[model samples]
Target: MTLRLLPLLMLAAATSPADAVPADDAPQPAFFEALRAADLRLATIAYRLTTANAALCDQLQPQIGMPIHALTQYAPAARKAAATTFRFGATIGVEAVVAGAPADRAGVRANDSIVEIDGKAQPALPGTDAPENAGARDAAEAAIANAPVAQPLRMTLLRDGQRVPVAIKPVAGCRSRFEILLGSGLDASADGSVVQIGEKFFEGYSDAEIAVIVSHELSHNILRHRARLDAVKINRGMLAEFGRNGRLIRETEDQADLLGIYLLANAGYDPMSAPKFWREKGGDIDGGLFRSRTHGSSKARAEALVAAARDIAATPTRPIIPAVLATRNVPLR
Candidate 1:
């Protein structure tokens, strides 16, 4: 078999899991740059996935159209870091712009400093007394995301030290928005309409691998796995604090893996990458509750992914759900 699943999975399974770092915990200013970079890449991949399957997203969530393609500057310590190599002062610049997304189409480019939105000057940073530019940047993001459907937002940007005006036209997409949490855990998860990825994921995984990870987490939201588990009255708390309901937990993991293959394929990514990522990257991720608890063994999960991809590839129509497993439900290990 071309699948190299066992090696990485075994390595990851054996490593100790790290506790999740709270976002409020402040790190050094130098770390913000990496967090910002990770946010850009993760957002780009997520935009591709969500927009590629807009129809499926609509089916998944009726309110499928709030957040468009745009990323804010990660400038938590912008004021404090001005004395460093970065001389931009407290100005927050654009970190990512999805190709052909509203912001990109509106003439916004990476590194452009957002100055004003809808003719209103931005507010001060959350922790600084310096003029409201930092707060304004955040306000600009909310402005774009919450803009009325079919309405265009007028924004003023400081690009190359010149004031440039742009118009961003918002479009509908899956209701979920993408976010990156700066921490040292290799994990990603979705809650309601939001898909959040850990910053460490970017340092550890390739773009294709990241896509597979995001697709799997996104699958959970699309399939409403969390809601379904709640509906079924699964005692997630007991399993976390007390003991094990390992089988049932593994069932959900299995279902997400199977569905994620279709999502990867539908988004024009290599379905085979799913298995490859597992083989090479799985071992670095099993931590905290992810430590040898509920998930299926690395080999079993990778084999199932390979099998599912093969079945999907043998079909003619682009299926939202694979045929061989359409009537089946894959449970967690």
Candidate 2:
């Protein structure tokens, strides 16, 4: 029951069903399938963690887990394909309902345009100067994510050329938007507001593996590691994660690893899977956290995680938040 098997299985079904979805009328670009699939995987797992561990988060967001997009974000060749497939317009629209999320439970579906939320007109993209405009995507997301969590949201959706109204009771969740970047590299990062991983991660990894990495990234935000690091004034350049400067960064990584497994467990993912993911995939990653010198070796990292996970497994009560989270705002040494 802790694994929240129903939501995991929903995402495991992965992508749209073959029988229900119609073929693209216009030829889609070669990358469309891969891109959509990757985004869906990232979004689903992030939703699972954020919603499940809402009580542990300091910042809260309304629990609408589906991602949105504007047509402008797509390259010219791919715009038609994405818009037709995802039901986006010049303005922002729901990319997919992300089955098992609050939106899907409220009867929202892929391609539905968010006409209004709580009686205010949804934010609109002002222009399309760049065919591939990632900024537009970010802006659109900010618009949608602004929906408040204090009450049920009265949302109007554009479906089948009709304006359909639905009331979605908002579930308070950890405030962070999860996204996937378009690349083949093994990059994963978190700003205070967003968590991003390369498309490559979703392609080769299973749900459990993806859950481990994403929980780690989300841990950075939950702990306010970025703000704390900024206060400590550590170098972030190519050779930064070395010597004295890297020690603080290493501490943050270790904290993330410790807290991350708890998040994975709280979300009903097996805690031990964290060690397995890092032990198997850490060396294969060529950049980001693994590139740091003071950060433990993959073997060391896995061992540390295994120890922590075992402790949690041994506890009579499961899924307790790490006490270190209490010191999140204390200045890093």
TM-score of each: 0.70, 0.85
The sequence of per-residue lDDT tens digits that candidate 2 reaches over residues 169-226 is: 6677888877665332577888777787765676568989988888989999999988
Where is model 2 more than 4 Å wrong at Cα? 1-30, 123-140, 286-289
Q: Per-residue lDDT of 107-206 in model 1, one digit per residue for the tens?
A: 7775565567677775322355443222444455556556554567777777656889987776554556566644335667776556777656666578
Q: In angstroms, how far off is 79's CA in candidate 2?
A: 2.3
Highest TM-score: which candidate? 2
TM-score of candidate 2 relative to the true fold:
0.85
lDDT (C-alpha, whole model) for all candidates: 0.57, 0.70
Pick by lDDT: which candidate is best?
A: 2
